[model samples]
Target: MTQTPSSSGREGGRSLKTRVKTARKRSLSSTLWLARQLNDPYVARAKREGLRSRAAYKLIEIDERWHFLKPGQRVVDLGAAPGGWSQVAARAVGAEAGRGRVLGIDLLEMEPLPGVEFKVMDFLEAEAPRQLMEWLGGKADVVLSDMAANATGHKKTDHLRIIGLVELAADFACEVLAEGGSFLAKVIQGGTEHELLARLKREFAVVRHVKPQASRADSAELYVLATGFRGAPGA
Candidate 1:
């Protein structure tokens, strides 16, 4: 059985946090990460509730506040590996009943999910737009990108990489979103995305950054939401 983290597990009538014993082969970072996961409420909740990942809660919380995902909304989930956000999208959009469409694209192979179409492809490739359009069958009502580049350990480089990925996602959203659509993407907190923000403002009626509670307090990650797309020409 999977270990469940709870206050009920106690020693001497006092609750204690779960700790991972460091193995000879385990790095300190690996040990700490395991310990954190073992203690995280979202991790336990995801397992209990049958969500694919804890990351699903981040998208759920954001949409709850923003009211983006809805019935009959065609959704595109870029970098949708592990199928967490796609699961939420399917349920929200009623895709299983054919009320809307949900398509997920990622370079990584993902197990199939009901009501969501999965494709293994790199979103940066030239054919990506065409393929996603074919799956969507028309302009999307919502575009979601939880994609992040691998961390390089250097703060500046990592931030720049995520920003670049977000920029690409935003550009793709602009190309394929219907008027009044919404775009949501992950971006790190920093000064780098000012130009991206300016461009989004020109194309979207509102652009804002939201940090979901599911995100660790120490993480610099934030989601950028752009709503009411203006449908730029040539896009």
Candidate 2:
């Protein structure tokens, strides 16, 4: 992997851009994405810091502001491929110190990380919540989802698809989060639907949107954070 340039994509007062030549088999979009990854400071930083992926910084930034993910807490990370969020959670919650526990679930198998247990299964499966709780030995203190649907060219359709994912993740969080726990999930610029936002407000004491600096300026991705979960009705 190429070493990351400075945050400004410059070094020693010289601008640097990693350009990718289009391969015969590679599409223009793929070439552009490769180039962007090569030039992204966060990507280089992640490599230098020995982190799993760039997504780790997003969680780290949010947690730094909120001071969530305390020691001895339990955390759940949905769609935790490459284990970036899981890595951050494990460290913040002191999982390596055996003070906390982290569970990472995804359809794709993760290479594995200390202090984190990876489960290769669809989080959308009917029994996923139950199984996750069983693995964690109880409810989680924080539930995170960085999952995003593959975008179609249609903007509205892409927004709806991501909202649908957030709704499902919120529902799952409610099922498995302990009282006063937190839930965070990825959403986009169009924002979450009214019904879902209203529901989150009712379920959690604080619900708001946050976009970390690690997220690209041109990208519409943002996160919805709901803290102080109030347990199920009549529980």
For model 2, give the RMSD to the true fold: 2.8
lDDT for residue 155 in candidate 1, whole number 0-100 = 97
Candidate 1: tens digits of C-alpha lDDT, residues 115-226: 9999898878887877777777888999999999998899999999999989999888888899999999999999999999999999999999999888988999999999
Largest lDDT belongs to which candidate?
2
Worst 10 residues of 1 by lDDT: 1-10
* Lowest lDDT block of 10, candidate 2: 1-10
- Against the unseen true structure, what C-alpha lDDT does each candidate score? 0.88, 0.90
Best by TM-score: 2
Local distance difference test, candidate 2: 0.90
Q: List the residue pairs that clash in candidate 2.
A: none
